[model samples]
Target: MTEACERPEATAGGAADPGDPAADRLEVRAAVFRGDDGDRLRVETLALAGPSHGEVRVRVRAAGVCGSDRHVLDGEWNVPLPAIMGHEAAGVVEAVGAGVRGLGIGDHVVIAWHQACQRCGECAGGKPWACTRARSNDSLLPDGTTRWRDAGGSEAFPYLAVGAMSEAIVVPEFAAIRIDPAVPFDVASLIGCSAGTGFGAVANNAEVIAGESAVVVGSGGVGLSIIAALRLAGATPIIAVDVSEARLDEARLAGATHALLGGPDLAERVAEITDGGADAAFEAIGRVQTMAQLPELIRPGGRAVFVGLPPEGQKVEIDGLLLAYEGKTIIGSNYGGLVPARDFPRIAAAYRAGMLPLDRLISARVRLDEVNEAFEAMRRGERTRSVIVFD
Candidate 1:
């Protein structure tokens, strides 16, 4: 954790201020970068706008480091840059904008990266993640703009429309999913993206059945989360494949009955474990080739899910002759098929019921100032989920 602020503790008394003036600022500091390849996020200060109509000002409590951020940094997911770069987060609603209903100041909430415009056709069609309005030239209203700025006059794009790397941020009311108060912000943070996507892949996408065999490749944060959800859902013979033994340990904790050392025969190992092929297979590393191989690991009529964010222009080739005869299906999972407002609370309730081990997946808790070290740990694959917590 960074030395600048104390670790956030659970409060019994009325929530008290931490006394850090930066905690309340339109002008603030954040890990930022410029250019489409928004890699190498640097610390900077900027003046950001506050909440406006149907928005809220959030004091970011904790934010999990997600692979999509890596994609943004690597320029694979071409996010507009000279921007703040975090999306998976949880926090308190410090201020609610005009017309915001059903939530109030001081509410604990998970910030959904997907900001759906309810009126948009995509949102009307049950695909909020595909909200075309999210990509509009003016995605942020003055209230939706970042809550930080530098001495120079320029705008900073927040990744997935809600960069939570900073001390505070301004987001849409729809982005703030009120969670069970019992859920810690750190655990709730993973619900924002990590748990949402991983678990959603199972519950919403694959709908894995009890006692079914499952495989999750590239067992990082998202992959491990899928494993956790499947375990809770009663999937058996769960196999986790990763190049790193340490992550494999994390996967075991998350609920993988078996961890296979990544190699040429990974698909074979999964097939062998399931006695033919897995009932379902998930690819989370976002490598086109790896994603393409997922179908081969599943049996005929089995389901294959891709959870990774592959780079632009990437393509994966497959053995069509075999797949055509197998009657296999390939599915692209977006945000784990999460319906934010509904799923966040359900996940939180599941956690409070002791049915979910969200804390086990958490590797570390650092203040916003330690954002750089968290990413470094991510680069080395040293952590399952490193959360950046605010005071």
Candidate 2:
């Protein structure tokens, strides 16, 4: 873990003044994605402005390399260039800006990519997961601006608002959720995105009841997380499918009752295991073919939860007639329909309690300079989750 920086005295409300020049000009090393195919991520020294109003500065300890980040690297998701491309991370608060209440310097935190505007209708209606204002693709902060700049002073965007790939970052107070210090940063980092998303999909979106049957169509980090949550939810006949035998073994370790290799006959095999079909089928891989096969893998009234994110502008062609005839529901789970402030800590607690095998999800730990290699491992289906750990 990175040592917390020297704490600056807070003002009356435990909030640091944003006008401090020293705070405004903090420099940090970050893995930058310039959107060029030849140069995916280059380690560079970047200047970061300290926490502004309703924000906090975090010294990142560990950041996970996710498939969503891979989407941007593969040119599937078009995000702003020269951005810090990471969202799943755990760190410690180094400074607090004006009006920051729930967090203070030295508090361990998990960075939430979706920093919902609490005043929005979706947030007010108790569905911050569907917040209309938190744009993950924009790469800009909630206020539509960036805190990072290059050596030549070119503004750089935080890929998904939190930008955990950097050594340090400034994010909205809501984006930094406090967690138990006992949890390891590397394990806690997966909770920020993959674990939280998977658990939320089961608890919030699918609402899988005890004895319910579920089939997870991917055994990657997020897929393994879903399998774990399904077990905790008391689901039965939990089947996991993936192309890699290694990930299938991981799925079994994460609580999959059965593991199967993904192929053209995947749906047929899942049906054979669950009698007619599973009560719920989760598509964790964002491929069109796998997503389209979800309906076939579930029972008549079963729900198909789309937990994986396909490339932007890509559409899946599900059989509308079949869906209507069978009364099957398709749910789109964004960030697993998670409310970060409420769910991140709960996930951390689960991890500490041994309810979730989060540490097993990390297949490789690399430094910031080796981020591209980690992503390549992900591309080759050789990893469950790769974390970039800072010194």
Among the numbered candidates, top TM-score falls to 2
What candidate 2 gets wrong by more than 4 Å, as runs, is 1-23, 37-39
For candidate 1, the clash count comes to 7
lDDT of 1 by residue, 1-391 (tens): 2321221233211212222223334666777867533356677886766565566778888888888787767667665657677888888887655555656777898988877677878888777877766642233533345444566776677776777787788777777888777899899999999888887899999999899999999888898889999998999999999889999999999899999987778877787889999999999888888888889889999999988878988888988888889999998898887888778888888889988788898999987677767878888989888888777
lDDT of 1 at 126: 78
Model-by-model lDDT, in order? 0.79, 0.87
Task: Give candidate 1 misplaced runs (Cα > 4 Å).
Answer: 1-25, 35-38, 136-148
Native-to-model Cα distance after best TM-score fit, residue 264 in candidate 1, in Å: 1.3
* lDDT accuracy of residue 365 in candidate 1: 90
**Per-residue lDDT of model 2, residues 17-88, tens digit only:** 554524466889998988666637898999998777778888999999998888888888888888888999
What TM-score does model 2 achieve against the real structure? 0.94
Judge candidate 2 at residue 8 and give its lDDT.
33
